[model samples]
Target: MAQQLGGRARSLQEGPGEYRLDNGQHILIGAYTESLGLMRKLGVNLEQSLLRQPLRLRYPDHEGLSLPPGPPLLSFVRGILSYKTWHLSARLQLLARATVWLLQGFRCKPELSVAQLCAGLPSIVRQELMDPLCVAALNTPSSQASAEVFLRVLHDALFSGRGSADLLLPRRDLSELLAEPAQQWLRVRGTQIFLGTRVHTLKQAADAWHLEISGAPQGETQCFDQVVLACTSLQAAKLAEPWAPAWAQAAQALHFEPIVTVYLRAPGSALPAAMVALNEGPDAPAQFAFDLGALGHAPGLFAFVISGASDWVAQGLKETGAATLQQALQAFNWRCSPEVYRVLAEKRATFACTPGLQRPGIQVARGLWAAGDYIAGPYPATLEGAVRAGKNAALACLQV
Candidate 1:
């Protein structure tokens, strides 16, 4: 809508080249239809840009779950039955729990955490699947993550459609994959873009918004008929505090979780699959690792991601990176010794998706809206949520 409404989109970075040197790795599933539609609309060739595969979570030792292509329910059943890592009784217990959840329509109490919801599951299932899945999907540990939200995600991914459980792994940098295409699409449609610009202050005058651009040589101010605060929760809170106090309060009260990405370089090294689930513990901080070589990046460049990484963040990036490197060496067979390339940590990567968390809604005020993953939504802080929120906010603005 910003592109069609004759407004400008500002970014602190000049472009993807200048910034985003090492952005956090992300994955998408077929369930994210809105995000897929947006990408198609922006001229991204989904088949070329992403590698689609059946849902497979292979651990370092090559033992984990792999759901084959078939009817969603049948595939799930066959996968569970074929899983040799867990005893038959454990698998049956999981199937029983899943059937109960399905019969209950995937609904759960808002106050229940994921850990509580799956307390009866086997330890192997919890350690290898549930724990990693919780952190990967919600960026929050199972002990504190919302059970209702997790169940919803599971329902959408596994039961929504045939290929909904398929993984779409990006084959290039984020900018080349989506951002650049989006920027070009907007530019072609006459949307002005202000790169390396920051909005220092936002003031409402009657029905319009007055924005003071930061770092402007002559103190530039711009007014807009409608405004969408598409920034971080804290930034939006600060801007909306004067006019939308209630919305600002909700935004301000949101607590955040951290994500750490450790890049390791080992020439001629590779994983059994594009992505591998790691066993996170005191020494192993990374819960998942991506084999960039298999995903079309520089050969032997692997990205180890640690979600819900508050403790590792406090331990210092260097120390955490070193520990992750050691963990990688011990976990996977390497052609050569791997070393840390870089450690990227986002302290406020996402709002902590706790049970019954009160998030600010999209409507900040009349003629004002907010578009971000942090906005109140069923999904967690994911690319799909961000895209859906943006589309919803744009449609809402049009309605107003």
Candidate 2:
């Protein structure tokens, strides 16, 4: 894969048939905004997948349970605006309804009436094109996730007007996706990213702030006018103690929710798309799906994405993750043929999506600030939320 940077072509395929990530697979169309736009402009490749198989969904009329006709931009907005804050139960029910309506509209554009749009779908996929790419990107189930967050993401996707189609897929390894790209970006920017050098203690000097890293004996210190604590809420609290004691204490008080991704490679079985979301019942563990085989030419490879998975975070991996994938495969009526796979446990994927949860100000003290998916933002802990938070924190630091 060749990536174009500064009008120059760069080889993305360093040494590979194709690289895969454990948490999920990322289809990098281009650079962030530019690639997204270009992919959308060029047209979506959704037609060349298992999603087009016209299979019956769980609930046809119940909403997101089935595919929508067109993009659910307006209905998504309406559902989000009408929903109460942090009400997962109520919110998902409405969003599912919106998903059905949107699918119906996308399929044939049957009617413009909101009432018609409100009709329930009979199966999982009511139409031809059931691309839940947006839902996957936000990491919130289209059925239960906040519409406001979806709208924000949708706006960003359509705003740039580029023809890029970005899909979020789960790979067998986590480090394959996050660590490498981050390392590359850091390398290009000449920033130090100490992977094993964990900061254990932090204190502010008269001028520069001192940090006690895990490896170094005496602890090396670095100086800067500002520091961006981009770690989790709990970790950020530790880093901000000296600069903002009270603020750090309050930051530590912020609660978090975990997410678990289970990867499964069914050697002979095939999945619908590069990614799909499973509509599980109340007690079920697994949630989403990613097709590794869809990326170029990998085969019988798939992943299960389990979000809001606090219950099974620390359980036996082969037992919980593998079993869940087996059950999920049963849902699709596919054989539970296990191959090479792994479970990615993100202890703090996001914080609770409550009302005032979005009100945590980014400005920790004066020179100190914070940025992450958990911090105050438009929605829950997601890529878009993280990006927005980072941009906002950078601006806050620059303004000072």
Candidate 3:
């Protein structure tokens, strides 16, 4: 690896380090080169297809060579019909209702451009699967995901094979499935990731930016070849304060949403599966639960997920997660209680969804570049958005 990258690999530490990741579990260091090999074997074509053809579907009448027009449309219609069934899990049902409301409001007032889009788009592509619950989870709403962003995601999901692969194999442990891949990718690509070391502040010098981190007294600074502020909006604002105060002000205005998940260690006898989505009945704090054991965990635990959870922040975790578990147990007869395990709350998990929220460019101030789920992108605060932002920031740095 060092020979391939030449002297560029000199500064980076050889091999990887073992660390205790979240939940106090020790993660052994290994070259997940095998995973990449498996991904290649799977023939998933995991690269961003939209990046290949940015303007392929931008025009209203433009139909590409990918899918047969009729089949794609039929698939969409089938999807719509399937969603209409009342048996959908409560999570999807709430999502369906929210989507209808949003679309109705949009259709009724009908802004000129939005209306034009609705009219111009092919009939097959008209009925979008706009899930507001998922959208808000990422930092923005489905309505505000932006036409460009929505189109890109749609093209990837429908035309390219990558989207279907992702949808087919949705993982139960998000932090492991999502972040771990990224960690490995960066390591393989010769980029260093120093986890557990939280960055506290940044200083810009004559030619490079200095990063100050936690656990260091006075201030220990390291100069990087190029700096990417791949963090939340609030962190970016604080980092930019000393150098570009105006940029900081703009970044601070961006708001974030909270995400919480409850892990229930129910006996295998309690439920046959680790995951389920409910679509009906009273408002439950959670919309979905994953049988962690089925997805490579202890057989007794089920992970319940809640996103865009602003209303439940002030409520005590014991109360919130317990109520959610009670609802699920009542419906499925899964004898599990919150008291059996743990509840994890990520308060500032993502940015909030609002129209015209301040999303600064990758090149906010000179050499400094912004990344993370927050940077201005079509879809608010999602992992995809973060990846796009990182790529954009990298490109910005390269251009400099």
TM-scores of the candidates in the order shown: 0.94, 0.62, 0.64
Q: Which ten residues in a row have the lowest lDDT in candidate 1?
A: 3-12
lDDT of all predictions, in order shown?
Answer: 0.86, 0.49, 0.49
lDDT of 3: 0.49
Tell me the spans in candidate 1 whose CA falls farther than 4 Å from its real position: 1-21, 215-219
Instruction: Estimate the lDDT of model 1.
Output: 0.86
**RMSD of each candidate?**
3.7, 10.2, 11.1
Which pairs of residues clash in candidate 1, taking residues 3 or more apart in a chain or in different chains? none
Best by TM-score: 1
Q: Mind giving the per-residue lDDT tens digits that candidate 2 earns over 131-235?
A: 243234444344434444444444443232322222333222333233444456667888755544566766666755566666544456655677777766788
RMSD of 3: 11.1
Reference-based TM-score, model 1: 0.94
Best by lDDT: 1
lDDT of 1 by residue, 69-154 (tens): 98777898899999988999999999999999999999999999999999989999899888988999999999999999999899
Tens-digit per-residue lDDT, 1-400, candidate 3? 1122211101112246521112211110011123333333433343421112111111112222122223333444344444432234533543354355345432332122222323433332332223422332333334443433433344334344322312222322323434445556668889765544567778777777888876444446777758888766887888888887877787898776666667666575344433344432236776555555554445566666666566666777787777777766665655544344666677776666554456777776778888876776655555456657777788888987
> For residue 235, what is the lDDT in candidate 3?
75
Could you give me the TM-score of model 3 versus the true structure?
Answer: 0.64
